[model samples]
Target: MGFISNVTGTLSDSISSELKDQHLETFRTDSLGQDILVKRAVRQNSFGRNQGSSEIISAGSKVIIPAGTYALMIDNGKIVDSVTEPGIYTWENSSSGSILSGGVKSVMGDVFDRFRFAGEVTKSQRIYFVNGLEIMNQTSNESLHLPYPDPVYGTLYFKFKIMFSFRIVDPVRFFKKTGKATTVYDYMGSPALPKQPFTEVQDHMEEALNLCGSRDKVPFPQLLSNKSKLKDAVNETISEVWYEQRGMVVESIAMTGLTLDEASRKRVEQFDSAKIFADDPAALQALVALGLTKAMNSAASNPAGAMTGFAGLGMAGTVAGNIQNGVSAFGGQSVTGPETCPFCGTPLPLQKPLEYCPACNADIRSYFQGMS
Candidate 1:
């Protein structure tokens, strides 16, 4: 029912010398790649012919488990034993009284009970190897829309392209969920494999992105640099579907691209332009000067008359010139002094002391008075 570690000179007691010579052969698998998740083991007959599908594994068959792979001994469509360690294993029939008398029960008692099978009577058995390496390059063409809240720019929405990888941490659970295939289970390439994990991750991506951005207070431009937090948030979001049920966990994620839609881009540009002028008074004064130049050019070509246009231009120039003095002359509108609100920087709305800022609702009375 289970495999015992192979020891020299011990097969003669359980198997006849002639039978051992015919049946005892090593069963080992080669290194598996990221795409291949599982592979069924095969054997050859005494005539060196391939035993395909209907071969019965005789007692005393040696199975070698290499590093980064797990082997399972299945009998009659049920998992009888499994080997996670890398070494040589010899199959010992539990029904054989001679082998069980030598304290083989202590070796396989817990494993046999785990699957609720006392022993396997028939020789309908097979060996399978599971790849334990990290499967990489799992990509999704679907774009995830992340709504990121920026303290300075309000909420900005963006689309992101993410690439992620996963590894099988619990082979037993994974094998149970995805049973034995004909020969190989191609996790990445096979169309027969279910696309639950990929689809589920994408389905939950938006929520995870929101949680990551909001919880960590990451700005919209910094989401790409915060890939680690995003990855953790995504894994935590889909833990029930991907990790708990499928025995697979996301190993790493790389954010390939982040882009804003046209509308969002225009909004950001407008805000960015405003911030540049607000942060630097010299920049604002330069913009006002440009406006004055355009007005004078339009006045010279005015159809009313050169003198009449010049009169209008003089009034516009006065208002433009006052921009440098932190106040506008037209309608006596005050251009906020250099001191703006510390929180939102919204010019403090005429610099009058107020209890709260109307833009961001921050208590600005103390801050406004201190600046005044």
Candidate 2:
């Protein structure tokens, strides 16, 4: 019995060596998590008669073997007892012994649950947001002091601190597209602009400013005064430009700072002061009345001017009354009020009749009566 056991062990070792020498079996796991075992038969090599230099084989390549699990096999021709552990066994003929069984068993283990990927914007990519606060310096002369630099004449230098938030909507797609998680602004930082600045970004800002019009006409500030409208407009604009154009989403755009040269600053200040004068309530009203009178006279000259002429006249009269009211109001003359609060002797609210004290609830009737 001892001799027989020794012979069997020796034969098993030989069989294992033979199977390993000749590529016999292979296994592969599919993407759907299925394992496939492949078997290939050993064939004569037609290449050269020299038995082909002790052909080295790896586990997954195919080769022929006697009816037994040979390549990477576990228990000798038996079903694996535990599903967690897999066994492959091979039976081979040895020169020393007739029948030999050799096998290997292993517990298949997994460390990673699933494959993952990270993504980022490439250096070639350019990203930016539309700023509604930038307005066109529509003055004919360049000396009018533009808020932004004129690329045509001077060296324009500015830094933009863009803020954007993005979430991975499609992990696979995002990984395939961008390749890593990174902000688009990171890509913009490299390759400092000396010879050729970001003219494209400047152009886009100009376009946005043009779309927004002048500061007074811009709807952003006005909308921002109302939180609900500001949010809605911001969301709409961001989605339209960022997502629709660049496959990105901008959550918000804030014009945090603006700078201009000393000359430009002085020019802007002068322009602003001139604008203030031009937009003075009394001045604007006077201008509107004059324009309306001219339009009324022009309408009156026509043959079918009856309706239009009367409408023009009504518009002119209304404008004139508004101008007079504005001038009078600006001259410290109240439309309807006592100069002082009746009960508290404080300055009364301008342009409205005072009946009672809003703060103290004191009856102002006696005070008004005393004034009369």
Candidate 3:
């Protein structure tokens, strides 16, 4: 058979074939390196060739690590060869030795020694194309439930929809922990990748989610109001986790939506409705009094709206009297003296003028202060 047909057709697909020197030099992925997602949680790549994708690096394949690509050779589940820099490289049966000891210079062959590996090219070696791109594209959407604190409502559970980008800073560590690599040979024909690396990636995001109640602590009410700063905090907090784990460097993250649970949603609705009244009862009362005054003034000018307002007030007063009478008639007997709360008309406890009404949680002491 001619050398062209032997190298081009037969050698490309067959792992068992012995590689010639020319084939070794030119062998590489058709495209650049790839982003291989780690979803298995098992934290490792499979042994030899994924047939699913378009690219699969067969055994005895020569590979050149293209620019922006980091390639590795895994033999029997061990990383035996790797090319980090952009260059042409042949995957030898053994490493040249560590650069620190100067063993690499001797192992790197002159132009002539490339003809043989020992005597012939080693058998059954695979090449993995790793994207040296600074940030890894997210393989899937990430959602998490995180605890967020609020000054008024305490801690609220929030549903965070997060998307992040990262890069492989330490390929060896990533491989050691994740055990994931892709070649052009497998079923997929590209790199055999894990299903959802972002899932494990979320393990590092807890501190950012919990907020530790500091470092841009976002209240439930302000979740949307203060999104930009909150995302920054999430990035800062999650970045800390990646740095410690040496898993991957977090390039950037975006929180698309931060939502509240059912209970928190209700609480926020109540807060929106009753904010002025809850924050300052006295002010609420003053506003009512002012409305009544306007109604009385309108009675002289145009008696219709005023008559309606006065009639409403009369019914309200009658309802209030009935409620007070009922409380007095059926409620518990006074535990303390006549320091009754103006709001609940409940007897006060030993907390004195500043005490709160147990029945209604009214600030009896503040009421008394106002009276004085």
Candidate 4:
């Protein structure tokens, strides 16, 4: 104790006996409230003015530190004490400034002693509560050009959209980079900066893609088909680089869209055309025969002597339609054959062969459609 006699003499000389106009210092952070983060009022004197805010701390004042919030006590813009634990604390002049100190109960005698004490307050006293929840979210408005191999096109450029979320994990680092040490701020605090740092995230994601070397294995023509794998690979890369030292955690990353460039789009269209021909090579070879069949079907539609030129074509087209529709089962039984599973010897799940059977992991495509 720094001479109780001198402390008492100083208090008696400075304060008045009358308690009518006496102001007690008290400060509770908005972060210590029900919301994830809260806003405090400006100083009483500066209520309507843009001058500044005042932090009040008085003896016996109750400090409530809530959950999911990190509270700090700043003396003239410098952090002096912090309270990470949620609890109620009453100030006593003689006790240490830090909230978790054990000496508070032993030193504080009563309201009179508490009133006589003036410990937590300094030349400039303020309390700040920072939300620990994940609030930072970023989305790529423009698609990133993702380069990948194309089996047919060699190299393809695909645009990708990304969404990511982050949380503040370190209070000290956050305070340093945020606004003025004295001002209160939130997720979108800075006017010049975005709510989240998307540009940095994009760079990290690109680096990850380069490291994974997915370009070597997949081609641009087949890029859209491999979307799931691409999303996973990029997400994994972001997780590793989202540093905790920045006092933030990257919570989630999602790939929302993938689109091809004009050249690649045209190439894909051509590939689809080639695929159609390859799938039905016989039809392409038999185009003249098909035209004749179509002419026969048109003549059959009218069934009149006026359609004399298309009479043969109409007949051939009708026969062709019947042959195309005839391959499947007419009633319960197939005119072609039953689509039985080759493996478990059960009927196929659907009329046509699917990738696999639900009941017994059998490849239904093994059974030919036209075999009796």
Best by lDDT: 1
Q: Report the C-alpha lDDT of model 1 over 18-94, residue by residue, as the tens digit.
A: 22223344587777776578888866456664322243554566788888888888876778888888988887652
In model 1, what are the clashing residue pairs, if there are any? none
Write one digit per residue (lDDT tens) for candidate 3, span 1-372. Answer: 587765544434332222211121234543343434321111112443322211223323345555766666665456776667887664545332222234344323311132333233333234456665654345334467876667566667777765556666666666565465443222112122424344445664566556634555566556565646655565566554454454466566655567779988888777765876556545455656676667556654664576786676665544444344434443434423445555655555335455655456665655666656
lDDT of 2: 0.35
Q: Residue 64 of model 4: what lDDT?
A: 71
Give candidate 1 misplaced runs (Cα > 4 Å).
1-22, 43-63, 75-121, 140-152, 159-162, 182-194, 254-258, 300-311, 327-372
Model 2 stretches astray by more than 4 angstroms: 1-173, 179-203, 214-216, 219-246, 261-372
Error of 3 at 335 (Å): 30
For candidate 3, the clash count comes to 35
The digit string of per-residue lDDT tens for model 2 on 123-190 reads 11101111111121111111112233332222223333222223222222222233332332332232
The alpha-carbon deviation from the true structure for residue 104 of candidate 1, after best TM-score superposition, in angstroms, is 12
lDDT of candidate 4 at residue 8, scale 0 to 100: 74
Q: After superposition, how far is residue 26 of candidate 1 from its true place, in Å?
A: 2.2
- Taken over the whole model, the C-alpha lDDT of each candidate is 0.65, 0.35, 0.50, 0.50
Residue 88 lDDT (model 2):
30
Winner of 1 and 2 under TM-score: 1
Candidate 4 structure lDDT: 0.50
